[model samples]
Target: MFGGSDIKIDVKKPVYELIVEHILTNYNFLHKQVSHHVDVEYSAVLTGLALGDGRIHSAFKRARISDENAGEIAKKLMDTNIVRLLKSRKQFTSWVDDERVSDKLLFTTPFMRFWFAFVAPIFKGIKEGNYDEFNQRYENKIAEFREAVFKELSNELVKISFAEEKVVETGAYWDREVELDIFAKTASKKVIVGTCRYTNSKLKKSEIAKLEELANRAKIKADVFVIVAKRGFSSELKSLKSEDIRLFTLKSFKSLL
Candidate 1:
């Protein structure tokens, strides 16, 4: 899609191979330099794990590569703009005071995460042109795959919802104590927090409770709350009769565009 033809998907090439080609095209460091390395296969394994797990330790373990090799692969990925680290949103809290926090690793885009999470791991089948097997595997796990994309959309909605205010911050919040799926603040200092449920069942009031709990543990009060749901809200949640809350379905999110 980059130039409409050269980088776009077609029926001829399998999706797994397409993503590999895309990465190989963009990351010249990975393409030109890493490919020349004696441990190229090892590097590719680490790259796939990094994209799939979003954890450095898990990536190393999955690849069964030494820490030294994993570190080199990570440096290449970072240098080539394929992946980046996300620092934990929890700061200046009880947990912050007690222990050191680690950053979460994230892909630069939704497609990269999707490709790595499901496609890249089973590359042999893809190379063998086993489209049926890849399709079945992808179909079975796509709902889980889209959660990351949905979370990204939910973050976008927070900014859209607060258009009147100067949004100072917006991102996921996590500490040893709790994790707020959507967190933000306005220039007026309004605290907004939320969560997303990308399942068939309706979102419930307990979700709000969870956000409140996370806020309490992190010692912050929210001036507004939002919910992004795929199915919709429960009757109890819809009838909550509260003014501080806003709800968004997948359909409603389109309007924000």
Candidate 2:
């Protein structure tokens, strides 16, 4: 069992090491009784899960483990009680209820989140000596990348919209049909909706219009409707402000941090 910070650290350790360290720290803080039992391959998966944002499929993909190896990896993790294998394809497919895994904490972490989002998608490219395409794809999705960055700095974002009463639940929200890149709800039921735009382009009225429509449909009367853009807002959009709308650029968001 990995306990008491006995894990070795190296100067040239991959990014995954940092991810594992973060997970260990977080888990220790959350539950003092928990300990990690990990090997190289399992470590890779844990690293993937920590970086991959709770996406198990992406974590497996990033570890470069084949379908054949997946079962073995799943078995190891499950046996160790680090993660529970929900579905058994060998017999039949079925769902595992959250209640079963709640105590087990069978979920990936932020490191795995990034791994699945970036590394796993390009496994073939890495194997076939063609990573350019994969790299380009990552570059194209800079908006999502920025949003992840925002998620990391979400605490500060909440601080800016401080109120007399402290809010508890603050996180992003997304559903099957509708997805809000950033969603924050206070204990008092005040909600904030934010959208992220990556390129140098400014946000258009059309985008704002869509968000407004979505918010109304979702039945969220957001107290603050924020728009986070990389380049900034357009003059036209900025000029036509409503009571519910606020604008933020990448610089402004970082400043909040």
Candidate 3:
């Protein structure tokens, strides 16, 4: 919707074109909503956040800036409500002590993330009325992009699903040796480890085994396992859902609605 009224959808227009016309091209529209403090340094940092997988260290590296500069910029961004940091989950053991793990820097809103990832990176060509570059890059990784967003949403859904458990803390978890899409703890100190798969096919029983293996490697004694998928689950996997396991599909998100 634009200007407090619904804009008619053009069925034949490409989604990107629609986005550019309705959002990107309208300078005044964005000027009214987004921060006006964006400078070259801020743009670079945003590009880094978009491409660096939200890792502070990686963002600095990807943006070709020093850690000190990036750290300063990140704090300012946080203060301005542009981005926020998610601290790395602390672990008791030192199984992968040699490897370094950094806290993640996330955009406060999806719109900012989308802008940096797709538009800002290729703004020169876009300004010249050439969208080939943007279209090519977007098409290649659109599924992966959507899945990343879905994983974040799944975190909220998981929190909502376990009403009795009362999740105390939840977020993405990564160690030198292992990574999980969903790593949460309940008020009762029960660990919940899970995965989110956005794919065309049904999630199989093997996916459960993989999550368990990762939890084992991470030394987490998971009391409940979760699987959120786009295309739902296989019949075999569906039949296995019990107190210990939970399965959720796109339709499961209706609960959030």
TM for every model, in the order presented, reads 0.75, 0.52, 0.86
Candidate rank order under lDDT: 3, 1, 2
lDDT of 1 by residue, 1-257 (tens): 12222345664887556654664334443234334432345444545443453556556667786767766776766665556877655652234366654456676656445545554556566555455665777678767667767887798878877778877788888755577778888888888878888999988779778767778877877888888899999888898636478788899787566
Candidate 3, residue 254: how far the Cα is off, in Å: 0.3
Model 1 per-residue lDDT at 31: 37
Estimate, for each residue in 54-166, the C-alpha lDDT of model 3 and write its tens digit: 88887778768787677687788888776788865545332446666787888777667776777777777866667788889788866766776898899999899999989
Give the top-scoring candidate (lDDT): 3
Model 1, residue 156: C-alpha shift (Å): 1.0
> TM-score rank, highest first?
3, 1, 2
Model 1 residue 145 lDDT? 65
Candidate 2, residue 45: the lDDT equals: 70
Residue 10 local lDDT, model 3 = 81
lDDT of each: 0.66, 0.54, 0.78
Instruction: Compute the lDDT for candidate 3.
Output: 0.78
Per-model clash counts, in order, read: 1, 17, 0
